[model samples]
Target chain A: MGFLFEQDNFALFRDGFLQTIELSALSALLALLLGTLLAAFRVSPVPVLRAFGTAWVTLFRNTPLTLLFFAVTFGLPPLGVHFSHLVFAVLALGGYTASFVCEVIRSGINTVPLGQAEAARSLGMTFGQTLTLVVLPQAARTVLAPMSSVFIALPRNSAIAGAFSVGELYSAQQTFSERGYSIFAIFFWVACAYLLISATVATFFRFLESRLAVVR
Target chain B: MSILNRPASAGVLYDAPGPKARARYRLFGVLSVLGILGLLWYVFAALDANGQFDPDLWDPFQYNFVQQMILDGLLATLKAFGLAAAFSLTLGALLAAGQLSDHKPVRWACTGIVQFFRAMPLLILIVALYYAFFAKQSMWALVIGLTLYNGAVQAEIIRSGVNAVPRGQGEAAYAIGMRKTQVMASILVPQAVRSMLPSMIGQLVVTLKDTSLGLIITYQELLFVGKKIASQPMNAAGFPYIPVVLVIGPIYIAMCLLLTALARWIEARGRRGANRRTSPAA
Candidate 1:
């Protein structure tokens, strides 16, 4: 609490906290797209696609995010692929989170009636066309809340960026600690920053959820 | 106009994987998979080429040091996870009861703890614990952090499970003069336990994986062992980092999958038990 009044460490907070938001927003977008596609494949009639999707989700979801981040930073270099720490952080966070999002979307997809797909096909729509025009829209509507939760979850998950030495919010906090900043103040502030971002994202999602629910 | 011409064949929905779409999907799938394999090959090849993968490069795995480190790390990981899991579940039950309690402060406090902890990242908690409490050799840091965060999650899960049980049963229990604790422990929890068994196992899976965070605090867990081994693999193999990752990754995967399969089995047995009890009702 006393550290809140200390103006020196405020610079770290401004930069590091903003980076966290940026990283989270990017990863959330990437994860949503990747997850939606994977969930689609998981439920697709193609057995191979379904198997591929399941394996991907299970592998990523089950592994600790720290190890995954480590794998990205340390594992890829030998293969002649080098990502900046920021890129590694986003890719690992996005890729890992996409797995969880896939499960959420799949659950939403399951809730959708079989008759809708059947009805769309009866209208002579291609599988892709029907999925895009009919199934996805409704599924998206149903998943609004869960997806919003996932979005809120992004900052928490982004904590792994700390491991990459990516200088994100948590990492910056660590630097301040090393510099002899009060541990309690730094952590308490980190917790508050997390709470603020989470509440904002959650409230925004609730608004979107109600909006979609009304349309339904 | 677009809504009227839909095909009427139910078979088309399941059966008709168009030839072009099927072929294209397969081609893309095969190519992507092959690309992954090729990537792996390139990794190993480069490591081999650099003489970094030498079999005799460094002797970190010499009789005592590496093995002892791994054993100690594994023990710490297990200890932390065990304590955290037990504490979290107990805390979760208490929190759940409070959330369901008639008292507003109790409910609000429980909810606040759950929300606040759930919102804070587990890694942040671990680091905070490190700085705040255990500055040195802090297994307690890891354990407490994991417990605080995971306990909140478990509380929510248990509460949801209990809520899923119809309301009439609770009212009936109250009518019979059963105490609140007795009602919760006897009727509500057992039923909720059966319903939430899968989720509990899922959280356990999460707890197991999170043990790797012990690495940040230098807690010498499995990944820590792998890292040490990779940097200094004995014999002629150069730094076997990727091999270490391959080894560790699958072990983690195997453990989680085994837990998942076990959860599935328990859920099946639970279903049978549920059916047997409810048979008369049915």
Candidate 2:
């Protein structure tokens, strides 16, 4: 445990922890936003929008995030598309995570009641207005739990960003290994760090759920 | 405008597009196609600018050595997944039994392990297992780490699956002089498998895909092989990054899709059998 407090280990681990947070947070947000768009497309009036959304979901969800990371990190550079490692990693994470989030949100939207949308239309609300004001708000409430799951999964998944040299928490393992520290202690501490993160996020979400649980 | 299709809508959610709306959708559709084509053109230009389209760079994949390496990598990946899957399922079953134990302390310990593992990232777990136990044996580390994390998840699945069995079924098993273990084996486990097979297979897909994470530990998995191929210039081009990824991406996607399809088939079979076993009322 004292090794965790050692100056070199402390700094590297701290940076790694912070990097993990940044990677997950930004990418999760991107996934959520893009997912919402895809979900909307899934149920949109336009057949083409619906098809495109479905296609996007199938394409991304079927593909593994590791492969997507490779595609962005290795594949895109050849195509003259360039970004910082973190940005590219985030894009990959966001794209992959979006497929899942989209499915979750679309299911949430389904639970909003077909009658609700029909009523919104009957009340003279246009498609966009009905979705923005009525459909999505209710869907948002229903999907909070799954959405949180997706968010939690983002951080866990972001560990792979280390492969792309994103300098996140898992990357700290390489540092510890290189530094001649006991692999046990280094791993023990890293596991504890991840456990702390996941546990904290989970508890926070649990607290929110209990505080404002949807009856359904 | 017949009431049959509903006066306003063609679907359950929204009104069918009127002529103007249809025209607009067509416009958007055309724009979408144009946009995709434009993006494709841009990517092509960018790739061509970097000599990524060079025929010479890709021709080497026709050789035996590279092909054998990839197949070997694939087999190694499957080997790891198989070990991890079996161990995790067995571990999951034990932990789930412990979690559902009548003894409070046993239950508590199981709960703690599952929660800790579930929350812990797989990468950290692999790294920890590598350093603490496996030492330089990266394969065991990857396998064990995957097992712990996935086993924790599978515990939840099993616990829920068991609990999902009708209370009457377990009580009846007990009434028939079956012990707890006998009841779990004879009654609950079978039903639970029927219900949980899809999810179990889903987890297997995750497990299969997760084997890719071994590359970080320098395990010679498929992704690692792909990386080696991608990085080697070997010819005039700097690296065949695009070609390697293009080749590898479809292979992974195919495997996942196949796994998912297999799960669906099993689920459908389960459902049909269930429907047959239960009366039509069910």
| Model 1 TM-score (B-chain only) | 0.80
Residues B164-234, model 2: lDDT tens digits? 98899999999999999899998999888888889988888889889988887788999899888877785
Ten residues in sequence with the least summed lDDT for candidate 2 chain A: A42-51
All candidates' TM-scores? 0.89, 0.91
Best by lDDT: 2
DockQ of each: 0.49, 0.52
Q: What TM-score does chain A of each model score against the native chain A?
A: 0.94, 0.94
Off by over 4 Å in 2: A210-216, B1-10, B175-177, B273-282
Tell me the tens digit of each residue's lDDT in model 1 across B199-258.
988898898888888878777688877777777634555456666676678877877788
User: Which consecutive 10 residues in model 2 chain B have the weakest lDDT in total?
Assistant: B1-10
Clashing residue pair totals per candidate (backbone < 3 A): 19, 0
Each candidate's fnat, listed in order, reads: 0.51, 0.56
